[model samples]
Target chain A: MSETVIKFGILGCAEIARKVGRAIGLAPNATIVAVGSRSAEKAAKYAADNGFPPATRAYGSYDAVLDDPEVDAVYVPLPTSLHAKWAVLAAQKKKHLLLEKPVAVNAAEFDKIVEACVANGVQFMDGTMWMHHPRTAKMKEFVSDERAFGKITAMHTCFTFAADPDFLENDIRVKPDLDGLGALGDAGWYCIRSILWANDYELPKTVTALRGPVLNKAGVILSCGASLYWEEGKVATFHCSFVSHLTMDITAVGTKGTLHVHDFVIPFQESEASFSVASESGFDELVTGWVPKPAEHLVNTSLPQEVLMVKEFSSLVGAIKAKGSQPEMKWPIISKKTQLVIDAVKLSIERGFEPVEVVG
Target chain B: MSETVIKFGILGCAEIARKVGRAIGLAPNATIVAVGSRSAEKAAKYAADNGFPPATRAYGSYDAVLDDPEVDAVYVPLPTSLHAKWAVLAAQKKKHLLLEKPVAVNAAEFDKIVEACVANGVQFMDGTMWMHHPRTAKMKEFVSDERAFGKITAMHTCFTFAADPDFLENDIRVKPDLDGLGALGDAGWYCIRSILWANDYELPKTVTALRGPVLNKAGVILSCGASLYWEEGKVATFHCSFVSHLTMDITAVGTKGTLHVHDFVIPFQESEASFSVASESGFDELVTGWVPKPAEHLVNTSLPQEVLMVKEFSSLVGAIKAKGSQPEMKWPIISKKTQLVIDAVKLSIERGFEPVEVVG
Candidate 1:
């Protein structure tokens, strides 16, 4: 029972943080002990509503909470541009870190975050939360089981949404000073992650990228595409567009069969995921026989996002508890790889959609 | 009935011509009176098997068919490299000409074909047969009809399929000098056509394109993408890939609703052509509640490739008979516009996917 309890602190009041706040309440072992925001009123309001005790402090500045000894770990839901600075500060204070996706705008910032965590002897994990979902695990299982779809040959993935032009202005997404990579750094990150996970995160032989018509007001790339290669001949293509209506779809076509996924990027309440498998003969009749096998089982994941985060974070905490010092967390390896691939894509786009090799 | 009947002359035994042959047989007002091919053996054998008269002469070259007194109008099915050569020659001979799609590889070639037909005072039609399909007409009506889907916001289209690597040795599609634009030229032309039809043939202001990974034998792009703008306000995007494992889909999203047309590229006999329109409120619901209106009419079209071609060619002949050659036999202005757009796309790919303007 004692080991089941883990204290959590919120460093920012973001829309995503609201979801995480709810998850922490639902998580069996997690407690929201403190809340902070750039605005004191916002911090106090969120703290009171999220079930923190009256004694639980509300801080106007992020530094006060990171300095608080009562908080075991901190969730950094700040803008992508601010992630590196705050994540490093949290690590230096010896607080475990769960930083958000696109860990930093670019590789250099990511390295700073990783270095601070390593030097401070603190645990760090990138909030690449989608992987914590069971459906992701199930997708991998289905692909690897050759009995289901044999000899994987190719995969195509896309994620996009029509974003409001108002939402695009002055946002960190459009600010090149923050090393803005735009769509490729944001939604396209998931596409690359899915591809890498499908292939066991093998380093691609070469990566090629292209960016679509980017309206100045709407940020760089209303759409973007990338092609990746693997050993002994395997190819993957991905596209992300902000100009289209919302969509999330991933598909893998093998020699003997094909696998399809629908509503992949966004999670629905009851039916978030759907997949269909078609054999060669079945493919011949795809126009008629194609059916979306309901992924009802993958929906309403019993464990909330906070619970998954806390549990993974707790493992690092447990290591700290046993050794009297925090061990290196999994964020650096995973985040580093993600940033490297994204950097290569950005380079490729700059070089006129040329193929860029992914080194280190 | 006598007035309804029209005579047709086919210039070759192309794989596509076979489809046209069947369509001619099925059309109410069409008859194949004469057939010609460079190989007398093959042409003579084909004439004997089909219902063409035994006297239908087999020639050693294309010019002989142009010289045939019995030949009225002609269907030209030749290599991608030879379409312009034979088409211009037939037009000069004053034969009503139905030339295959991509009328010529570039805008200049298409212009030459048009000039030749005008000088000879004959009917000229590019065999972009899909325009003849009722479904295409229906799609245009649905998108343009405000009562149907409302104002169109965006359109996405794809047409790609892997081909045999050795296809290039005998296939002019592999040779750039033969006007081969690779995947972007071949199947991509269809995707562009679909978008052009949907958008009412609006000329794009700018086009940004990216060449996909190249294939082994063809050394041409196996995959490609483009982002285009008809105006500052309206935009369209498309993807074409020969390396893909065969997929063809088109979707149009509008202010009030969305329309999805699957298998837009290749509507095989087994393929189902269906579209779903979603209400504004109902669109928010992820599953079943979208209130899908069923579309049950099946065109039951001919499966052979030549079927659509023959139907279109016969229709052109019937128009000439009815209108007495008052510009009724020519391809629509949209055909020329489609070639112009595609030509700009090729330039975009060559310039590393830079945005290219389509000159008015």
Candidate 2:
């Protein structure tokens, strides 16, 4: 079982890369071989500050990271607008990709990235760390249990952060040319992913943007919401904002069970996570209170969720390299599904809040 | 404070009547004086079965209870369609009214009932028991605190219960000629009230019903949701259904804080209720976990919420009778606000999911 570690080269010294760099240091099957930024000096400082091994290379450009013979994969944390260019180029250079999310500005752009990955046969995974958390698997089990959860009826999720004045004015997320999709893409990406995950990756039929979405002067969404409808009467709604307090939540209700997780995007603590579930809930005899109250389930993790995400991605890359196996399609498939719904929401918002049929 | 007690007269023996009847027994300032139904035999049995005092009268018709000289107030839990006629008649009889939720099918009917109560000098209060809960007041304090909660930006609430097959077909809530507003009127009533309550009863500028609402064969809404938008970019959404697992929740997000209550309509226990709040929350240095996690605040109640509702109503009635005070307008004002939003949602759904301006 002791295989060669998957060597990773970070594409940018973005703030998120600091966390993922620590994850790579913690992941047994992953190691950083190179770090890249627009300036080699900045890349070297990021690697030094983040405690990458002294032997690690600092590249002046992302192309140098992809060109390195020792780099088995690239972690793309570049601004969303540069995603298609670098992700496709990284794939074409025969390197696997672990891309930060809202994988592309739009689904079509993502499709092109996937096309390149398929052409080069490189593994693909988005940097949604919560998906790798052990607690998420436990939650998925509860929501999928027929006896415990029954048919899923509705779900609500939100991811919001109160951006400071500097962030609101100059952050890449609010810039039309950087993270062009804005809050609807950055914060909303997690909300959409959670909804799809709880629904067992089943895509809803339509997405309708709620009215009164706030936008910056550059026409980038600052806060927004959308409701998704499934033909079987299953509905899900999500809200994402850059102008609200830091709040991450997911509530999924089935015919017989309900699941709630307030820290779906980030756990309260690094070592433990918790969620509440109530099955076959009803009122007491006098209807004064619940008969069987919701029970909180705690999951303790040996490693943080981000570490697990890196480990999982490394294992997949190792499989392709050592076993000559096909790259895992599950991750990109889910990423595409999330992107499709986001595209639908964007279209719905553009169309004066009309219901846009989701193209799966 | 030791003035006369308010003697209550019950309407039909609907299932909810049993719960309120228990609350009346618990409230020191409220007493059951009469029980009324279509048949005298059923009324007598209901009174006996509920352990009513031997001195309490059993009336064959609702009119008899309204005319009872000893009955100072009426607890009208009749089907919604019967509310306009019987509630107005009771008000005209100078009987103070404690009406059940969705006080009438629509605001117009509710307005008529209010008019009758005003003309006859009778106190009017809808039986929204949660409003009287001590926990609700405690939660309100948190949401209202400018330092703790900040300006409210978004809110979401839901009330859903899985109805048995028989209830789906025969329950008064689903019957077109009876409690006809179905889930939107029954479960959704609580959702609307909670949203309005959190926002300090500031009506939303518009209400747009979500698509894919489930309806019964008789055109009664069985499942529905809507998004309410305020002009200042604040928004709220709610979902109600008769076919999902029982879940009552309220999540209010402000610029600096978030409030979450899992059991808003009914507490998990009679003596204790809890809610979670997080103020100025953010991630830790590594972004692996929350810095200041959400803190759970438990509020203990000496009496259940429904008992408090009865006590509050009876105390208001006592002030009117003993001090010749005018009726308190707060309860009716909130009820009217909730009903107005519901009417707007209904209208939006009728207009093919268009945004309906809420006329406060």
Q: Assess chain B of each prediction and give its TM-score.
A: 0.87, 0.99
For all candidates, state DockQ relative to the true structure: 0.13, 0.84
TM-score of 1: 0.78
lDDT for each candidate structure: 0.66, 0.93
Give the lowest summed-lDDT range of ten residues in model 2 chain A: A283-292
Runs of candidate 2 with Cα error greater than 4 angstroms are none
Clashing pairs in 1: B19-B306, B19-B307, B20-B306
lDDT of 1 by residue, A12-116 (tens): 877667666666666666677878898778899887765556766788989888988988888888878888889988988888787777788788888898899
> Lowest summed lDDT over 10 consecutive residues: which window, candidate 1 chain B?
B281-290
Listed per candidate, the RMSD to the true structure in angstroms reads 5.6, 0.9
In model 1, state the lDDT of residue B331: 68
Winner by lDDT? 2
Model 1 complex DockQ against the native = 0.13
The true-versus-predicted C-alpha distance at residue A266 of model 1, in Å, is 0.2
CAPRI-style docking class of model 1 based on DockQ: incorrect
